[model samples]
Target: MFKVGYFYTDCLVPMVGNNPYATTEDSAAELSINAEVYSLPSRKLVVLQLRSIFIKYKSKPFCEKLLSWVKSSNCARVIVLSSSHSYHCNDLQLCSCPFRYLLTPSMPKNVQNKIKSLNWKEMEKSQCIPGIEDSEFCVRIPGGGITKVLYKESSSREIPMMVLLKFVSEGDNIPDALSLVEYLNEWLQIIKPSVNDSTLSALPWKIPSSWKLLFGSGLPPALF
Candidate 1:
């Protein structure tokens, strides 16, 4: 979706690590920077792609700086795509859809109503003290790095923000990624379904070449 001519390089977040590595072949050739921003003027949308993991104890500060930048840019809203640990799901969560969304209280009512119309499940609050039935309930997102903090900060600042997340485990996450995108499309309508296939989107998503070796190089023939 962020192809050249469609999206232009906007800015970079320099608060991440100094690894200076690329996550994909396209990025290796065109972008070597860590947190890069791309903008699609036609849609008035900005996408921040983080290519590296954040350093320990820096998530809050990074989120603060990010929100500050958003405010300065005068963006209408923020949508965060993230994932949590499927293993941490509760009984109710396991029985329902693995996808969930969270909206800041400050989000526009119209947008909230639209989301509600889709019947999307909101992220549920878990017991603050695990195993304690009477303990207070709070939002819990295990394995969702920085998502919880970012949501809280955005709410406190009254920034219109939405978070879409999936429950997944450690492994090839390509399918999980596709599922999340489809979920987001339900709200954004970025890709319209074809008349021939009402269940499928018009555009076919191609897996990036970089993911060919996602599980690692083929086993050495010598080993067999």
Candidate 2:
């Protein structure tokens, strides 16, 4: 399993329990935690949440103690949560030190491609369309499967676990949403699969009234 580290402030702890993905100490995670931030729904929520956890009890020793935690922690990636007030895109960025990575779900290939087609860049320096940014946490695999976890490094110990996010393009093609259901359906074949059954049951989300107006009663997506 990937070791994901999340640091949020104590103030937001109460609110996180409401998140469908909110993790807890009892989970089989590498670690579950609590943190502090200035307030809820921050202007710079994600970073502020990290800051909150960094100086939870006091603000005096912020930099020094955080650096120590970074050096000692065995986490591979960081997951930062933004306050409800955030209105920007769904993405994550890592700082320059510690050879670290940031994992933000929904940063899928389709989203990236759509962003690029519109000539938007993920960061300020590069246009989203022109660059292929680095991300170790989520890797893409061809032929419609995702390699989620490669547990061990050695050749003999290595294990490959595949996850299908959604389906693909054009003529005689599978509908994206329906294909996603099938993709997830394949997970049943794996030994101790990562996905739980509840998610599968939520196969199709009820389309909002606004979305119905946009897509004309939920038409299946055709590949471009």
Candidate 3:
């Protein structure tokens, strides 16, 4: 099961496209929850989208409740797809790759093993303070927006959660989203493996119609 973000997760839901074998709608009056549920029986996948504008105070409680629901629903694990500010990339992280992941301490052993088998690079352990010897190395996301909170909450509750993200900056982010999906597919295989990078890149991915206006009609004709 996945609770993908509408924007920061690289617009993953739209990339998943629409229509499934079954569907449902769920909301909570007390929590300002509005979501559309999609079920793909053949793939045994369920997606819950909570894409409304975020208010910090409201989102804190909302995430708490959502985690509780996930626990009750017997979800095997949670994978959060998000991005980090490219500027936050450190020298070590920059040298290795733009991608990194964090696994909650309580993730299943088998799950942990599988991730290892893939030879994926885990986020680097870096100095908490540049010159403080006793300071601990910790994970930080300067502009990750709610991702840090969700990871902390899930970790505290012992929920098996994994976050996969890239270091990126604002632009025509459609390409970023596509690149992100390709990264995710390396693990999930939501789309079948292809013969080559070119073939793999050609896999049909549908972007939301809303994106037609992503660039906002361009440069106003560059009036001189």
Candidate 4:
């Protein structure tokens, strides 16, 4: 049996004035017109994919203690999905089955740097290109998010992963390699099996189908 736990993360994208994108019964009228809009107000959207999975269980007392901390914390709910019951990136990427997990979560350095800056206006307007839009700065607020993720190391084997995530708004920070691990731990605690368990049984970890949504056209990196 397999299970998936999930949470809702919110984001705001300011539309300058009112939500020009807001649609009324009338299609002919678009209240928003072509204009220079920067430092837009925060707009809200419910991102459906801010999630992680807990698919393996190694009965370590220390892990148990951590699990206790998560349940007590109001931060958010964490869930994990893995093939071998471990979230090890190596295992995930080594899986014989072709997968896209690594492709999605791997945030490029260029993008990550942009996310850290608190001020958007300070950003050079010219450098912001189409792939990287202008007038948008993303920052991720910890403790405020509703979901967490952690990827455990595989015992020996490797697995492939494909991931898909949607940012309801681009105003928040992008998940980094390190940050992704923190959330993964949160999920591990929630779904980790009880003690007295020796080996990792069947777990909930797996590369998901969301990648299809993101790289609908772009090809994934080939695993050698």
Candidate 5:
């Protein structure tokens, strides 16, 4: 399962746009969920999506409820995809990699080992305040909305969760989405890698029709 933020209406929504296997109708839940589930006799993968509306105000309850539902559903792992302000990248963070991950204390040992084998950098931890033992070493995402909250709450509950995020500035985030998906593929293999046949048809993933409007027809030929 994955939860993506739409801070600028560009976080990860487009990735789920085109051909969702399932979608939620208007509902009364704190958030709406649309899912694409791929199931075999032995394995399953579900991609979940929730719009970022009202998350700032209701993140705690929302995440708790969602995690509870996931627990009930017998899901084993959760991966959240999101972005943070590139400017917030510290000297060390920037020097390391464009992407980082956060792992809950309860994360499976195998997963942690895989991350280590890949040599991916985990988000550096910092004290919430200048100096306070109570603050402790914690991963901080300066402009990453709801990411910290979700990680904290999930960790407290001992849910197996991981977050993969990129450092980016707001703009044409379509490229960011592509980069993120590729990064995830490096870990999850969502799309099969290849040296030939660059078409997305090689995978079940579909591009949403909404992407066509990504860059509009260009200022009515006047602002140019």
Candidate 6:
């Protein structure tokens, strides 16, 4: 969805390694060490894509800075696409849909009502201490990386934000990604389905060429 745009360098920083050369085979001539931003002015959308994992201790600071930037940019709202470990889901979670959503308290009531109309499930609070029936419940996302932190920060800062995530296992997450996008489309209506096709399955989506070798190039024939 965020294939084309000029580089947004304001928030760019060397948060990861300092290697000047591209470390992976799929990357272009230069390395990707900073978060990238893509703007779709026609649609008034700005996508901030984090290319690398944040250093463990820098997660909170990064989220704080990101929220500050959002406020300064005067963006109407923020939507985060994330995932969680399917294996970590509780019994109730496993029985229902794998998709879930969260909205900051400051989100507009109309938007909240819209989500409700879609009949989406909210991220469930898990036991703070596992195996203890009476343990306090708290929001936990085992493999969600910075999702929880970012959500909490956005809530406390009163920045209208929404989180859409899915329960997925490791490996081949392309289908999961497509499903999440479809879920988001139900609310954003970024792409409208045909009148004959009420479902999003027929929506025209162009996958970027860069995704060709997503997992990596094929092994050399010489190796065989």
Candidate topping lDDT: 1
lDDT of 6: 0.79
**Lowest lDDT 10-residue stretch of candidate 6:** 16-25
- Residue-level lDDT for 150 in candidate 5: 84
lDDT agreement of model 5 with the native = 0.70
On TM-score, the stronger of 1 and 3 is 1
Best first by TM-score, ranked: 1, 6, 3, 5, 2, 4
- Alpha-carbon local distance difference test for all models: 0.80, 0.30, 0.70, 0.28, 0.70, 0.79
TM-score of 5: 0.72
Q: In model 1, where is the ten-residue run with the lowest total lDDT?
A: 3-12
Off by over 4 Å in 1: 1-28, 199-203
Tell me the tens digit of each residue's lDDT in model 4 across 1-224.
11122221122221222222333446324333222222212311112222232323422332343334434543232222222212322343344321112211333445334433422111111222224645453322122222122322111112111221221223222233223433333322434654666674433443233333433565657732
lDDT of 1: 0.80
Clashing residue pairs for model 3: none
Off by over 4 Å in 5: 1-43, 130-137, 195-205, 222-224
lDDT of 6 by residue, 39-104 (tens): 777678888877655665767777778788899988899999999999998889999999999999
Residue lDDT tens for model 5, 105-183: 9999999999999998888887877358788776778777788888888899898999999998888897788777888
Per-residue C-alpha lDDT of model 1 across residues 123-195, encoded as one tens digit per residue? 9999988899899999999999899999999999999999999999998898899889888987887766677
Highest TM-score among the candidates is held by which one?
1
How far does residue 86 in candidate 3 sit from its true spot (Å)? 0.7
The better candidate by TM-score, 1 or 2, is 1
Compared with the true structure, the alpha-carbon lDDT of candidate 2 equals 0.30
Candidates' TM-scores? 0.85, 0.21, 0.75, 0.18, 0.72, 0.83
